[model samples]
Target: MQELKAALERQALAEGFAKMRVTRPDAIPEAMGRLRAFLAEGQHGQMDWMAERAHWRGDPAALWPEARAVVMLAETYTPEADPRAATLLHDRGAISVYAQGKDYHDLVKRRLKRLGRWLIEEARGRGSAAEIKVFVDTAPVMEKPLAQAAGLGWQGKHTNLLARDLGNWFFLGAIFTTLELPPDAPETSHCGRCTACLDACPTQAFPAPYQLDARRCISYLTIEHRGPVAPELRGLLGNRIYGCDDCLAACPWNKFAATARDIGYAARQGSPPLAELAALDDTAFRARFAGSPIKRIGRDRMVRNVLYAIGNSDDPTLAPAARARLADPDPAVAEAARWALARLGIAIVDNPDMPEP
Candidate 1:
């Protein structure tokens, strides 16, 4: 199994994975309890799926009874520049560094499948019947905890997996296999007293040092939550349109994280003018973000988020962008437009269309 493990690591690297380690299916003993508590407190917000699949996600062994090992891998997508700089561009909408490129689900999963197939072939050649399942973020899998269990990284105080060497910019992918493998020692948190990630959140999403309240998170508000965001938090959203990267970028470990090797992870969707984004109809939005993860959020949600960004932009020049969406078809988009207009101090008197700032 040690030889197989070595071979697997080599194959994973060849498949473009940054790091790979093996762990027992039941390695993450505390995952179920933490997940239960997080759900009990309603911290997941609109993501009811977490509660729905708690049984499987809490225990990887339970997800697949015969699985003897969880092969955790990291796929780096570190941004070439500071993502926070884009958030400061008042007229532009800031997309998270991860989403600025192709959807990682497609990218990582394809590589995982390739690696998994190689593992099966290599194991059978050694006279072992190997059964496996590969999973990205979409599956009912607690990858961060499992990654920590495999010694790939520890879950930082911000609740994302960050390696001392790999920083905070990698994606996690899992391959559960029936062939027993040597498990790596688990990694413990190195965050210590550092509050870098906690202090950088624009919406103060962190309830405490390590706990997160998704309901108040700008990433969740912009991407997950439907309808208009809470008025108080709308202004706090600033220019972030897709997802917020403040906490991740704030981590000191990022200094060691290398930029992405795969050109597909490059920033093809750099910050665009809020006016341009706000005007995207369904077809245009779909075409613009065809291979992007942003496409999943749909045109109305994107426009709704753009209007919110416009509201928080503070630049009066972006007012027309918000004003035009006041009569948008989607109730949420229209509401966001009105809020943006009001935030800019442009009174929407009798007409749904506001004059100017």
Candidate 2:
């Protein structure tokens, strides 16, 4: 078992995992309380799934009694260039670090399976048949808390894990194993007196120091939310078409973070011109975002998000792009595009005084 643990650590590091830790399957007491309070306050917006699996999400052992230990892994995927730098060009869209590359869900899961297979093989040789399962953000697991507890890092004020060495720009995955690996001491929080992330949110999603209201989060508005964004928050969203990173990029501890090693996760497609994105048809949308996580939202919702971004672009040239989308086949996209074009002063002269429905 000792040899297995050592070998697992060696192989994990060799496989490009920045940090790894073993943890007991336990509920994070402090985080559980915060989560319960957040859910009770209805801060999760239309994401009812967070509330649906509350019990299991809060407790790891309850999720699977057969699992004896948890293997938490962190992969750093920081971009070489500043992710927030492009946001200053308000006419251009700002893609979050996580979304700027190939989907981490698939990439992380495949590597985790390799790690798990190694663990199982090593355990089997030592007279134990280990049952293992790898998860990347797909389950009802409270991954952030578990990652923090596993000593990968402490949860930052933005409620995401941050390591002194890895920073907040990373992907988290876990392997639930039946082996009893020795657990490491957890990391401590260091977000003392820092309100940078909280203050930087465009929509002020962070209601308090550590609390987040997903309803107002631009990441949710552009990615998860399926319909037209609230008119009031449209301008605030800026040109972040896919996801928002105001809070993540605002963190001060990211100075020591390493650049991404896997080229597969690098930002491609030139940050995507807002005007071009608003004009994508269904086939073009799928082809462009193929193998990317953004495709999950489908063409209509994706274009709907782009239209809102166009409205916030503040560039009259983008007005024509939004106007072109006004007749989009999808009603949701058409309506949002119409709203954008109107806001950009491209509407018919007769409808000059009209407001968006």
Candidate 3:
């Protein structure tokens, strides 16, 4: 079993995974209580799926009862350039580092499936039978906790996994098998007294160390929350039209982060002008982001986010982009346009005598 484990680790690294660790399916026993507390406090906001699959997500043993060992893998996607630099370009939209390239879901899953196939064949050749299943972020699995239990990394105060060596700039994937491989010692938190991630949030989304309120998180507001955002939070959105990476990029451990080995993760979606994104129709939006994770948000939400970014740009030249979306078919887009125009100090009155909104 130890020999198989060692060989699997070598294969995983060859497959582009930076690290791989193993643990029993039932190793994360304490995660159930933590998940319950997070959901019970309504911290997840509009992500109803978290609550829907609470049982299976909280307990990986229950997710697949026959699975004996959970193999956690990490793949680096560290940006070559400073990811936070785009936010300074007021007229351009700030895209999160993770979405700057091809969608990680497809990339990571492909590697995992290939690795699983090899494991099955390798086990059989070794006179043992093995069955395996692979999963990426799309599953109900609590990947961070599972990864920690496998000794791959520990969850930081920001509630994202960070390793002493791997840092925080990586994506996690998992493979559950019916083979009872030796389990590694679970990693303990090394965050200590650091508060860099907490202080870095533009919206103060962290209520306390290790606790996040998705309602105030810019990422959730821009990506997951539907319709117009609260008037107060709009200014805080800055020029970030997609997801926010402030917390992850702010981690000090990232100094030791590995360079991304997958050429597919190279930045293709550079910071695009807000004017260009705001003008995109449904078909244009889909075509522009065909293979990207940003396509999932659709045009309505994307344009709405662009409008909010325009509102926060502090550039009067961006008012026209906001004005063009005033009559957008989607009410959220129209509302965001009005908010942007107002923020840009532009008057919007249907009648000459009427007061500007």
lDDT (tens digit, per residue) of candidate 3 on 1-357: 999999999999999999999988899899899889989999998999999999999999999999999999999999987788898999999999999999999999999999999999999999999999999998899999999988999989888999999889999999999999999999999999999999999999999998889999999998999988999899998999999999999999999999999999999999999999999999999999999999999999999999999988889999998888887888899889888988889998663332232
157-214: candidate 2 lDDT, tens digit per residue = 8888898888789889999988988887888898999988898898988877767889
Candidate 2 lDDT score relative to the true structure = 0.82
* Tens-digit lDDT string for candidate 1 (199-305): 99988899898799999998899899987788889889888999999999999999899667788998899999889999999999999999999999999999988
In candidate 2, the residue pairs with backbone N, CA or C atoms under 3 Å apart (3 or more residues apart, or in different chains) clash, namely none
Best to worst by TM-score, what's the order?
Answer: 3, 1, 2
lDDT of each: 0.91, 0.82, 0.93
Superposed on all Cα atoms, the candidates' RMSDs to the truth, in angstroms, are 2.3, 2.4, 2.2
Off by over 4 Å in 3: 351-357
lDDT sort, best first: 3, 1, 2
